[model samples]
Every structure is written in C-alpha cells, then in structure tokens.
Target: MDNIAGSKSSLTWAVHISVALLVALWLFPTVGLFVSSFRTADQIATSGWWSSLSEQESQNPFIRVSGDQVQEGDLYVIEGQLFPETDAEVSAWGTSSREPEAYEPGAVVDLGDGQSLMVNEAGAFRMTSETDMEGTRLPRVFTTATTPPEFTLENYEQVLGGGNGTDSMAQAFISTLTVTIPATVIPIVVAAFAAYALAWMDFPGRALLVAFVVGLLVVPLQLALIPLLKLHLGIGIGKGYLGVWLAHTGFGLPLAIYLLRNYMVGLPRDIIENARVDGATEFQIFTKIILPLSFPALASFAIFQFLWTWNDLLVAKVFLIDATGQTTVMTAKIIELLGTRGGNWEILATAAFVSIIVPLIVFFAMQKYLVRGLLAGSVK
Candidate 1:
C-alpha cells in the first residue's frame, strides 16, 4: 500500500510539471508579442520584451545639451535636464566618445580651458565656463542611466490608422471582417441544412454522400484554387468579394457539414420522430427542433470558419485582392509590412496582435458552445 501510494504521488507531480511546462512554452511568445507592441522601436531593439516590465540600465550615446546658455556673473552657464520629461537617474556621465562612463554623477570635470561640467543623479546638468559657449553645434553628453519600465499605446495607434495614413491596417481590418462574416454565415446556413438531411432524413446514397464529403476533407485545398478561380472568371464572378465568399463557402462546407452531422446524429432520435408523427412538416421539425438542439455544433463550426476565413491570405490574394490593391486583408497587409517595414518590429507586432484580437474574442465568446460540442461528441 505504501509503495503504491508513493508511486501515485510521483506520477501526479510529473503530470503537473509537464502541464506547467507546456503552458509556459505556449504562453511565452504570446506575452512577448503583447509586451513588444507597447514598446518603442528603440527599446525593443535594445532590450528583450521580458525585461520591459523592470527598470534597466542603458547607455545613451551623444545626447546633446541645449545650446541656449545663460550668463552667471563672470561665467557662462548651461543648465538643462539630460533626459527631458523622463524618469531616469544618471549613474555616470562623460563628455567624450571613447570613455562614455568616465565621470560619476555629481562629480565635476574640468576641461583644459577652465570649462567645468557637473551632472547630478537626477539627470540635471550644469556647465560653466569663463568664455561663452560658441557655434551652432551644442555639447554632447553621454550617460549611463537607469530607466523605469515604460509602455505606450502609440504603436497600436499607428498600426490601426492613427499615424501617417500609409501602411495602416484599418482598411485590411475592415476587409477581413467583410470577408469573414459572410463566409462564416453562408457556409453554416448551407451546411446545417445538409447536415440535418444527412443525420435524420432517409435518402438513397446517403452513406455514399457522407463518404464523398469525408473524401473531400482529405483533398488538398490548393488543388481547387486554380480551377475555382478559372470557373469564377468564366462565370463572370471574376476576382472580388463575391468570388472570395463563394470560395470560402465551398471550402468551409464539408467540415461544417461533417461536424454538424455527427453532432446531430448523436442527439436523441425520439424527439425528432415524435415531432414528425405530430403532423409537423419536415421543414418545421428541422427549424423548430434540430436547429435549437444543435446550437453547440453550429457555434463550433461558426468559430472554425470565422477563424479560417479571417486569417487566410492565399485565398484572399487569389480571389479577392485584384490589381487595384483595394481589397487587401490583414494577413496580406502583414506580409506587405514584412517586405516594406521589415525592420519596424513595433509596427509588425502591433499589426499581428491587431489581427489576432478578433479571433481570440470570437473563441472566448463561443467557448462554452465549443466545449459542450466537444464533450458531447467524446462522451458517446
């Protein structure tokens, strides 16, 4: 008994540790992206996102002092904050390029010609010289400072149509919504009818039709793109929202039908038959009974189709986006940003996060239905 109890305890601990590891592995990158989106480009370039939440030591190069000098009796003085409008403490300061941290904060250093500079811990600096500070070029001060964690909404604002008008994902966001809603709704509407027919109605070749749809699930979607595009062009639908909607509906139908049919089939058959025996017409029974009971299945398929349609770039490129470039979607826009603003990680992270937010919202909103469908299917 003792041995068995010890083994069980060990196994439970191992399982807990494994789960924790898996969760961390999946969560780290998502958290990193979320953090990176709020950081400036320079901060992101200099430090990892994991360090963004903590104060960090940084070396600043050639921060220029204001050229405006005030006279104090016999000496000319320049007084200013090293980092304006920031919460930072300078640990060390220097006046030359080679030795950036040569002087400790509050220590006065003298140049050969009676010029002296002092930097305080609060990043305030004072320069006094017998001669007036000359020329348009101001003196540069280099410092090592400790900066508190900083975050901003500027990246998100810029990516979502608030910045310099170009390269914003606002248009793409709208286009994705336009593509996803119709694509998800149309397929669910069509697939629900097909699923009900497959699940409950007695028709010839029923098994064969189910098998055909299952076969379609295995067929690569890439195979249909060319032929479908050609057909769309031939039939005068020709590369637009309508063509993309039709393509998504066709692609999404088989899986939706299969999922809904399986769920509908598992439902108690007595209710359906009793409703039919009560003189309820087939359409009435379907509308009033099956549709209501199959909410979980419908919700599951809607979430699936919405996510797929929203994230798809290849299909949008082939069917929706034309030479005019007006119908671009979020995924396509991210790809464009990669090519054009590849170095701008703040923009990229913000754009990617913006694209991800909708699917996450939909998933969470419909999660109860999704979980119910999955559990119902598994238990039986």
Candidate 2:
C-alpha cells in the first residue's frame, strides 16, 4: 500500500509538471508578442520584451546641452534637462563620447577653461563658464540611466490607422472580415443541408457520395487553386470577394459536411423518425429538429472555417486581391509589412496580434461546443 501510494504521488507530480511545461511552451511566445506590441520601436530594439518589465541600465545617446546662456553673477550658465519626462534615474554622466559614464550623478566635472558641468540624479544639468559660451553647437552629454518599464499604444494606433492612415491595416481588416464572415457562413449553411440529407435521407448512391467527400478531404487544396482560378475567370467572376468566397466554400464544404453528417448520424434516429412519421415535411424536420440538435457540430465547423478563412493568405492572394490592392486582407497586409516595415518590430507584433485576436475570441466563445462536437462524433 505504501509503495502504491508513492507511485501514485509520483505519477501525479509528473502529470502536473508535463502540463505546466506544455502551457509555458505555448504561452511564452504569445505573451512575448503581446508585450512587444505595446513597446516603442526604440525599446524593442534596445532590449527584449521579457526584460522590459524591470528597470535596467541602458546607455543613452548623446544629449546636447542647449547653448542658451543665462547670466548669473558674472558667470555664464547653460542648463537643461536631459530626459524631458525624467522617467529614468541617472547613474552616471560624461562630457565626451569615449567615456560615456565617466562621472557619477551629482558630481561636477571640470573642462579646464574655468568651465564646469554638473548633472544631478534627476537628469537636470548645469554648465557654467567664466566667459560667455561660444558657438551655436552645444556640448553633448552622455549618461547611463536606469529606465523603468515602458509600454505604448502608438504601435496599435499606427497599425489601426492613426498616423497618416497610409500604412494602416484598417482597410485590410475590414476586407478580411468581408471575406471571412460570408465564407464561414455560406459553407456551414450549404454543408448543414447536404449533411442532413446524407445522414438521414436514403437517396440513391448516398454512400458513394459520402465516400467521395471523405476522399476529397485527403486531396490537396493547392492542386485545385489554379484550376479553380481558371474556372472562376472563365465564369465571369474573375478576381474578387465573390471568387474567394466561392473558393473557400468549396474547400471548406467537404470537412463541414463530413463532420456534421457524422455527428447527425450518431444522433438518436428515433427523434428524427418520430418527427417524420408525425406528418412533418423534410424541410420542417431539418429546420426544427436536426438544426437545433446539431448546434455543437455547426458551431465547431463555423469556428474551423472562420479561423481557416481568417488566417488564409494564399487563397486571398490568388483569388481576391488585385492590382488595386484595395481588397487586401490582414494576412496579406502582414506579408506586405514583412517586406516594407520589416525592421519595425512593434508594427509587426501589433499587426500579428490584431490578426489573431478575432480567431482567439471565436475559439474561446465556442470552445465548449467544439469540444462537445469532437467528443460526440468520436468513435466509441
């Protein structure tokens, strides 16, 4: 008994550790991206997002002291604040580039010509000379300061159309929505009808049709892109939302039908047969009985199709986007940003996070249904 209890305790610990590790593996990058989206370009460049949450010593660029001289008791004084916001604590200061942290904060440094400079911990500096200061170019000061963690919404603002609205993904976001909603909805509607027929109605060659759909699931979607594109062009649809919607519906239909049909097949046939025997029309039975009972399956397929359409770049590029680039979706916009604003981590992170937010919302909202449908449809 003692040995068995010890083994059980060890097994429980192993399971807990494995779960924790898996959660961290999945969460680390997502949390990093979320943190990076709020950071400034400078902050992202200088340090990692994980380190951004704590105060860290950083070498600041040369900050020039204003040449504007104030007269004080026959001495010329040049005073200025190095950091406007004073959010950082100055640890050291220097007058030359070679020795950026030559002097500690609050210590005065002499410049040999009856000139001296002092910088306090608050980043306030005062430079005084016996003679009037010369030249329009001000003396540069460097400092090592400990900056607190900082976050900004400017990246989000820029990506969402705040600055100039030129590089914004707002239009693409709308365009993606335009593509995803209909593509997700139409496929589920069509597939639900077809699925009900395949599951319940004993039509001729129904088994062959079901087998064909299941076979199509293994077929690669890439092989169909060019052929479908030609077909669309030949049919006067050309390249637009209509073409993309149809393409997504075609690609998504097989899985949707398969999932919903299997789920509906497993459902108690007595309820459906009873409805049929009670003088109910086929449409009425499907609408009132099958539709309500198949909510989990419908929701599962909706989430699947929604996410697939939302994240799809190749299909959108091939079928929807044109030379005008006006109908570009969020995924394609991120690709454009990869080429154009590649160096801008904040922009990339914000764009990526924005693209994922909708799918995540859909998943969380319908997760229960998704799990239910999977469990219900699983082979017992």
Candidate 3:
C-alpha cells in the first residue's frame, strides 16, 4: 500500500507543519526588522515591532516644562504642550518621578507656593504662579500617553549618510559592492572553465583533483585565513580590493568548482561529442555550448558566492582593511556603528536591512536555479 504510485506519505502533514514553522521563524524577524527600519527610536523602545500598526500607550520620559509667560489676573501663566506636534493624548501625568501617573489628564494640582499646574488630555500643560516665574527652574512632567503609529524615512537618511555628512555607511556600501561583485564574478569565471575541463576532457590526475575539490568543501574557512593573508602580504597583494577579491575567490572556488563539475557531469554527453565531431574547438564548445547549457549551475554558484562575499567580515578584515580605513565593507561598517550608534536601534535596523537587500535580491532572483543545480547528478 505504501509503495503504490502517487500514494501519500503518513508524515506529509508533519513535514508541512515543520516547513511552516521554519518559514515563520525566518519571516517574522525579517518583517520586524524591515518595519523597525522606518520607526522612530522611541517607538522601537516602547513597543514590539508587531505592535507598531496600532495606537500605542506608553510612559514618556520626563519632559522639562518651558514656555513664555502671560499675565492673567494676578497670576503669571506659562502654557505649553508636553509632546511635539502630534496626535498624542495624555491619559495621566505626574509632577514627581515616583508618581508618574498619579494624576489624570485635565486635573489641576496645588503646588502650595500660591502656584498651580494643569495638564490636559491633549498633552497641553499650564502653570500659574502669583509671582513671576521667569528665570526660575520649572517642574518636570511625566506623562502616560497614547500615540498613533509613526514611521519615518529619516532613519534611512542617517544610515545612508543623507541626514548627517559624517556617516560612512554610504561609502561602505559602495566599497562592499566593489568587493562583492568582482569576487562573485571572478570565481564563477574561473570555476566554469575548471568544471568543464574536469567534466569533459581527459586529463592527468583529474579524479584526484575532483576529490580534492570535494574535500575542500568541508575545510574550515578560518584555518586558511592566516596562511592566505601571510602569502598575500609576501606576494605584495597587500590589503585592498584586489586582495579581498582574491581572498573571496579562493574561499569560494572549491564549492564553485565542485558544484559546476557535478552539474556539468550530468549534462547530456552526446551534445559535447556531437559538437566536437562538428569541428568545434574546446574553447568554442565551452564558451558557446557548455556555458549556456550550464547556466543553472553557474547561477547557483553565483548566488552562494555573492552572499558569502557580501556578508564576509573576517576575510575582509584580515586581507583588506588597513589603518587608513579606506576599504571598509558593509559588515565592518555595521560593527563600527555598533560601537558608536549602538543605542540608536532605528539607525542600526536601517543599516542592517540595507546590507541584506542586495543578497535578498540575488537569492530570490536565482533561487529557482539553486535547488535544481544542487540536485544535479544526484540520481546518477
């Protein structure tokens, strides 16, 4: 019964449930981060990102009272709003820190010095004193208020270096693209030629080389960094775009060659034989026939290489970043921001999303090829 054609598996529902859980786990944080990138700092601190769409009730920090005074009767008066111009409604307020919500909005309190203060529902406050209140320190007001949902592009402006001229995420964004594009392209170019040679043409030690490439896929990347950096320094590659590109290419190549080789091996053997019989040279066959046919494999490797290189910090740190700070990547820039703007979640969230945006685009655009390419040659 279980082996019948098109029979359903007993565990299909379990698999579906597991998959749904995994997808939700991945999607929720991504959505939260995206939403958080547009939120204000206070909004982020006060409530979870999921709560951002509805009215939020929160306890605002102490706001020192300030305003010009107007004389009404024998009392001098100072009036102002607690919050900035917004639709915030004060539900409760207090004059002291310990009793932040002791008084309801619109209640008047006697301060016992022939002065009184009133805080209203719309976050407005008025203080009256028989004596002049000018040049004297004013009481701080703590309020609990409900505010409508808020979002802004100013976080992006600060992160992208539009708000302040001092931010370096913009420069870092360009530098990361500089490193990642070449690193991705160079490995795919190198690996395709190598894969075709291993998959098709007869060559000495070919089996050994294929096994070597497969073995390298399991090697810890950290094990190679120090030695590779030393070799680079000795050879005058130094620390720059060239060095980082080379570093990523080297780290990326083993899997690249392995994947492309597997996929190429599964390509119809007769096509190559026919092309060769028709007098097509090796280079011509590779460029015209092999590359075009092997696009899924190439695309898969390109996606992996691009994501790895774009997010890499250790390799960039060891092989590229110098004392001058000229070649910093997005990952490194975000770390620097962590030290400097750590308290500013809005800026941090915006920068984090910006860094992943390109990788997300690359993955989704080529994701159709990823599974197909990886599963190539598995059955055979």
Best by lDDT: 2
Q: CA lDDT of 119 in candidate 1? A: 91
Over 4 Å off, model 2: 1-3, 110-115, 130-135, 373-380
Residue 367 in model 3: lDDT? 79
Candidate 1 worst ten-residue window by lDDT: 371-380
What is the Å distance of residue 245 in model 3 from its true position? 0.7
Worst 10 residues of 2 by lDDT: 371-380
On TM-score, the leading prediction is: 2
Candidate 1's displacement at residue 218, Å, is 1.8
Per-residue lDDT of model 2, residues 1-380, tens digit only:
33685588878888899999999999999999999999988788889888988886788888888847889999999888888874889999898999998999999888878888999998999999998787745568998998888889989889897576557889989999999999999999999999999999998999999989888987888998899999999999999999999999999998899999998998998998898899999999999999999888898888788889999999999999999998999999999989988888999999999999988898888888777766754434
Question: All candidates: CA RMSD in angstroms?
Answer: 2.8, 2.5, 3.2
Error of 2 at 34 (Å): 1.1
Query: What are the models' TM-scores?
Result: 0.90, 0.91, 0.89
Report lDDT (Cα) of residue 238, candidate 2.
Answer: 97
Tell me the tens digit of each residue's lDDT in model 3 across 134-209. Answer: 8988888999999999999988888786556445488888999999899999999999999999999998999999
Residue 11, candidate 2: alpha-carbon lDDT: 84
